[model samples]
Target: MWEYTDKVKEHFLNPRNVGVIEDADGVGEVGSLSCGDALTLYFKLDADGRITDAKFQTFGCASAIASSSALTEMMIGKTLEEAEKITNDDIASFLGELPKEKMHCSVMGQEALEKAIACYRGETVPKPEGNIICECFGITDRQIEATVRDHHLVTIDDVTGHLKAGGGCGKCHEDIQAIIDQVQGKPMPIRSEAAPLTNLQKIRLIEETLEREIKPALHQDGGGIELVDVDGNRVMVKLRGTCAGCKASQVTLKKTVEAKLRELVSKDLVVEEVRS
Candidate 1:
């Protein structure tokens, strides 16, 4: 259920250049079918070293196809040097804005362009060197580090949204978190060095987090949260207004409410709902 922009939808529904050039000067292929996304870029350069034609064939969701189409269009009329300067952020910016979770689709376009340029120059394409950290998507530690540093990612979910590293199975979440901390220069807490929280301290922090961080966000969507009770590490809450019976309430509770509480209060904090 990604909210795609009008431009994204247009390119996806009717891609501009959807074929290969038999005599392309540069051909770059990236991604994998197993990952549910792939793209191939073709470009023909004129005698003046300016790209005269660019085309692409992409297999993925609407955003993926749109990103590929947009990339090819952008490459047309640019010199190789100019095209090389294009980044994933630039592609997303060109399309106005992409949903956070679909940002990786633009990353794929960037990788394909690099590979295509390497093919044109007859340079050796570097292989992935780091150990695999996310098995579900075959993401490597080197990939994670580069993405975290490039994007200035701060949270595990940000990494997930950008690279989908910790979105499946979640075994690599701790490793992803560690990389985020290193990139952001925030040290991960060591259990022995961490200060213990009293019951009163935990309760007060939870209340403050709900008031300061969670409620304001919910209120924007015509929903709200009421802190019902606190027992040990458990936080009982009641959904009010529109959120009370919304079909997406469970997702809100887990991904939004519980996630915020755990991030601000304690890692072991659990959130539950109380019915009348």
Candidate 2:
């Protein structure tokens, strides 16, 4: 649970502006399903082009919900320019401070304000561009690099917590882990009984094994393997079509698929079957 301030907790528990306006002058939405946090902001402009009303709807954790609520409360009655200048720091400060790990929640509020301002101005904000690193969260390589450099992130978990990258379905956990390895100038950590592979590494290794071994075996069985994600050391793999009801599925996962992946990659990997 987050150690939220009284104000933050109050607003979260009894959030204001929880729904959309019927005739909003401008609206903006950001984050996404993949990111595990999404926000929709609605604004009503006055005759003087100031924000007479602001409202928000958010789908995320407690910090994210509180941040959106606070943002809406602060922006109402402010000019669009004034609202645009409200930074993440300002939002956090207004809330009496957020957890360092949840600082990204405040940043999301800032991003939503910028997008709403862009909509009011009829400007087209550019889509984030770079190699797609975290497919589960739609986080780009450039964003990850920039965040790591700016914050001096030293671990893959730090990067994910800050950017919400590898926090979801976790398909890109390995790619993120590789980035961490490269940045730190260390070889990927050797998985030992004392130091097990991280969740991200396990996910990556699972994908690698599926592509290299398990997929071919399933194809031979007139079935296929779809890599879902990794949560902790548990690797979730979905069995499709004919494989769903097959008796051999458990045998394949335990004896063949799990064994082979563990042998080739890390001994800590735990393969789990998921229904497609």
**Most lDDT-accurate candidate:** 1
Single out the weakest 10-residue window by summed lDDT for candidate 1: 184-193
- For each candidate, the alpha-carbon lDDT, in order, equals 0.87, 0.79
lDDT of 2 by residue, 210-243 (tens): 6645665676667877778777667788887577
Q: For candidate 1, lDDT tens digit of each residue in 113-197?
A: 9999999999968987799999998889999987876565668888887887888899999999888766556433333318878
Off by over 4 Å in 2: 33-35, 169-276
Q: What C-alpha lDDT, on a 0 to 100 scale, does residue 197 get in candidate 1?
A: 89
Hey, what RMSD does candidate 2 come out at?
18.1
Error of 1 at 105 (Å): 0.3
lDDT of 1 at 60: 92
